[model samples]
Target: MPDLDPPKRSRWTLWLVLLVCAAPVVASYFSFYVLDLRGRAYGDLIQPTRDLPASLALTDLKGAPVAAVSLHGQWLLTYVPDRACDEGCERMLFMQRQLREMLGKDRDRLDKLVLVPDDVNLTPAQIDALTAHGAPATVLRAPRAAIEGWLMAAPGHRMGEHLFLVDPMGRWMLRTPATPEPSAVKKDLERLMRANAGWDKPGR
Candidate 1:
């Protein structure tokens, strides 16, 4: 009779693969919840973290296709902007950029994302503003409904009024107040960086 058992080395390889895939999720949970770090987080810690939806579709300003899953592998400082791109939008953009800068050496591990929820035509100046300061942000357009389904805004406020933070694993884990204090947001970013240092590194 032929042996049905798998090789011991093959079993070890499978277990190793599973551990590698689950490390980030485990680290995040232990750092934020079990350690009571949630109490210290400036941004509201989302219970039952929401994973990035595979069905979410996105496109660039020029209408080129962009995959939503492509955003995984970096901490995301996300802002959902209106088609108009008014004063509030500009302020949020500035704040998001500055918060990443405040990360100091860990900056590259974080990416700034401006998700436009409409098809409004952006003037050259608007595009320049988004890419200003040498550190360009990834600006993409997705359907308003898709954005609404992914990011949660504070009660009595629209999604554009707040900033959302997503983990490298593509999970939506933090949501700031409608008008977040930059200093407070910075502290939260720093804490997360330190907590995940063992598993996360700069670049993808």
Candidate 2:
């Protein structure tokens, strides 16, 4: 007669493999939902989470139709700048870039989306500034009406005053400070990446 059950060592090995495989998913959920993230992080969790609408018309830097996947496939740190990239606006833009870069090896999992009103175009100087910073030449633009309806701001703050944290599902989840310390923002992002490491990877 042959033994039907596996040996004890084999059973333990199987359990170990299962745990290793599931570690990422468990850690990710714990990092996001169960942890006391607010005490030490920069994210402001959005109540009644707002997801970006696919029907909303979007245009890319090339004046080409924007793909729906671009908005939702990766973790996004977004900002809305006025028509003119003033000194303050540039500073914010710089911060956004620097913060993403601070992610180091995990940087690819994050993206920068600058939302601009449809009625405005970037001046040559504005383009040059963004270019000098190695920013995408043709940034994405969305209708002002849509931005107002879709994104929420903190009390007494307008759309242009804060950075948005959108989840990979395209849901708007967090509202960051208008002017955040790069190191502080990096910490927040690192926590998020750690929490989601099991499920999230670099790239869309």
What overall lDDT goes with each candidate model? 0.84, 0.76
Model 1: CA > 4 A from native: 1-4, 7-9, 119-121
Q: Against the true structure, what is each candidate's TM-score?
A: 0.90, 0.79
Model 1, 19-102: lDDT tens digits are 998888687669756674657877888888899887888888888998888999899999887557788888888899899998
- The number of residue pairs in model 2 that clash at the backbone is 3
* Candidate 1 TM-score, C-alpha based: 0.90
Which stretches of model 2 miss by more than 4 angstroms? 1-27, 128-138
Residue 55 of candidate 2: its Cα lDDT?
Answer: 76
Estimate candidate 2's alpha-carbon lDDT, on a 0 to 1 scale. 0.76
Give the Å shift of residue 147 in candidate 2: 1.3
